[model samples]
Target: MTVDHVRSLSSGINQTGVRAYNERLLLSVLQRNGALPGGELARRTGLSPQTTSVILRKLEQDGLLHKGVPVKGKVGKPSVPFDIEADGLFSMGLKIGRRSADLLVLDLKGEVRMQLRETYDYPMPDTVFGFLERGYEDLMSALSIDMRSRMCGLGIAAPFELWNWHELVGAPPAEFAAWRDIDFSAEAARITDLPVHQVNDATAACRAEHVFGMGREYRDYVYFFIGAFIGGGIVLDHAVFEGNQKNAGAFGPLPVPDVQGKPAQLIDLASIRALEVRLEADGLDPRQLWQTPQDWSHLEAYVQPWLEQTADALAIASVASCAVIDFEAVVIDGAMPATCRARLVEMTRTRLSDQDLRGVIAPEIIEGRVGNNARGIGAAAGPIISQVLLNRSAALLGALLHKLGSERTSPFPGRTYPTGSVTGMPRAV
Candidate 1:
């Protein structure tokens, strides 16, 4: 994630050629460091002043960079800093969870411009894609023609091996088996001409935290996203790192000690779904757990005990991950409200103190700020960062695409035209 020096590159945005690596390098610097004058940008990227000025002008004209307030220095001309234009581009993030789904628009600045959510017992094909079709229309209709034109692509954050969780979600065998053949990225591509990117849902949350939340504060950390099932993502050298199969921080299966000193999977003890099971066993309305605009204060009595157990499991998982990476912090986030996140973080810290750390240096436990909306927002970031901005994971995405047989390096990757939304695309019976 460190910005290294690259020298002598020239390719204007208007010209019919590839976007210069130098330009993305400059954009990456501005993105990480905020507004800086040409000289400062040059110093940061190791580009000469002339090259920096030219790239800045091209990016500004291309609607990617904009001028900031002039700052008078101790000497010469009052230099104007250049900032990544917040409205310069737009992308969509779709988070497909077992209990609900969300679609959102993200600007270059990592802010959510618009979002829509739907809750369901389980994700049925028609229901999921029907919601997507409607959400895409509604979201795109709300955008100005210019904004719509600026739409980059769609990114999907879905759980890994979604079909395998049918039993846990109480779905019928037939309905659950349908998920085995679902290629979310391809299905999404049917609606918008924009290139579609897919990532593990928890990793998407981690990406959001890295790009817009606490990621800037630490270079190496393990992130846990407490959703229907507890999951995690890894950050190495400041970028979200998905390993060879794109499942590096799959923490659900991580071993933790139960209250009886018996071994258990982190998911068994740490997930929100576990809480729902607790509520159901007590004859409380479990659906309330998945409701949007969530305030678990209503279920405070039930939440307290769940919180304690989840915190204990999280503390152990945090230590186990840090033991391998020597991470500086364990950044914890979830598909829950800020209050819940705060309590979990506080409790985790306390529980962490109780773990037997004979050899490993326990990492600092930090609360995530992105909250429940993180997976969707992180999904949105994938396309924008792949096309407009720069990230270390960009290379991983390229490799992934290559494995899928596409070397997409443009605004449009494989198919360069919008096919428009159809009721359905290819599927198996």
Candidate 2:
């Protein structure tokens, strides 16, 4: 179907009350699993068979869902399946980094429709916001989505250290000078009225994996995002574990044993900066790093020791996490190319496997499927899901509001504003 046609079908739904809740349940099931039999969906979502039938009928009629042919089974009658019309919805995602940013438009199935990227000399909030607004506007215009309501909310992936008010209440230090003390949601709201959601870059990437990538295989896992820096996300029972300050997965600061019998943080040992510094000290020109593939290979050799150390540290962390959460695996993702991820996974597995420790099951370490765009894609998907849920709730609220005669402005929270700042920082390598 044409993009416009699909957008129209999705926009036509009256989201609120029972209808909204039903839609949310239906979409959630479809998202978690690409498709399922109507009976299976009812069983999984805990909705009455009659209720499920009604909701499925409405969704199919609205073009948000479609029915599949019956599948033959050995022991029972064939049943028709329901699947999400993924093309019916679309979302935009943006990842803001210190030196560059990536923007992507994705369909409901998590496929990239279009991408635009740019590099910047400095990380100024105002300049970044201007670039983003223009980029979003240009993308929307290109897509011919003139109506704001036709578009879902915007999601941003950024890096911001979350600390308790008592620990670091004032402005952040100079290391994070560019992003310190900025209220992104408040500022972004002034520029556009769209709903904006902010999340940590690694956490967002983890969300993308949980929703669309390999993590869908396990209910609990630790996601290590290796980029300019090293960051991570912890998922338990399919929900992200954001700590009291919403910063539980700051894996960078976790200390690892060093050669000097002291301990250094993972970022100090594994970050891209560490590799760059090592390469420069070895007589390699730093500027050639990004331009030459061979430079990366050479740098890879120099960091082998650090990589091994990182594997050991990760093994320890994995064992500890498993003891507490019984996590199934530890996933490594981010800017590392596919080959590099494979090598790391292999090395981590071998290292952990060699340990003779008792009662320790070496968790599988797998490369992430989402790659560098994981954060951006997750950022994009966040809003689409939020808006879909909100749209459903809004429909029910509208009916109540009509009966109540404006006694309630909305049953939900006030509209969210945007801030130019991206969410979660890259992991501190």
Whole-model Cα lDDT of every candidate shown, in order: 0.80, 0.65
Cα TM-score per model: 0.87, 0.77
Task: Compute the lDDT of residue 115 as modeled in candidate 2.
Answer: 81
Error of 2 at 259 (Å): 3.9
Question: How do the residues 1-429 of candidate 1 rate in per-residue lDDT, one tens digit apiece?
Answer: 110100001112213234666787788777776788998877665567998999999999989999999999899999999999988878889999989999999999988999999899988877888888788877877777667667777899998888888888889988789989887877877765557899999989999998888987787899999999988798876668888888878999999889898989999999989999999998987889887678889888889999999998898888888778799899888978788889999999999999888888889999998888889998999888777665568346445445544323334344322111120110000
- Measured by TM-score, the strongest candidate is 1
Model 2 misplaced stretches (Cα beyond 4 Å): 1-19, 70-78, 146-149, 162-178, 282-306, 389-429
Q: What is the lDDT of residue 385 in candidate 2?
A: 72
lDDT (10s digit) by residue, model 2, range 1-429 = 333443343332224213365577677667666788888877666567888898889888755688898899987899888887765566777787644578778777788888877665335576667777676666665664433334565688876543221122233345346466677776654444446788787778887887789976876788888766678788765556666665667787776666575877776665555655677687975544334122356566766765676676666556666666666788987665566667777777876776654676567787788887888897887777775532212233334436544233333465222211111100000
**Residue 274 displacement in candidate 2 (angstroms):** 2.2
Alpha-carbon error at 133 in model 2, in Å?
1.7
* Candidate 1 off by > 4 Å: 1-18, 394-429
The count of backbone overlaps in candidate 1 is 0
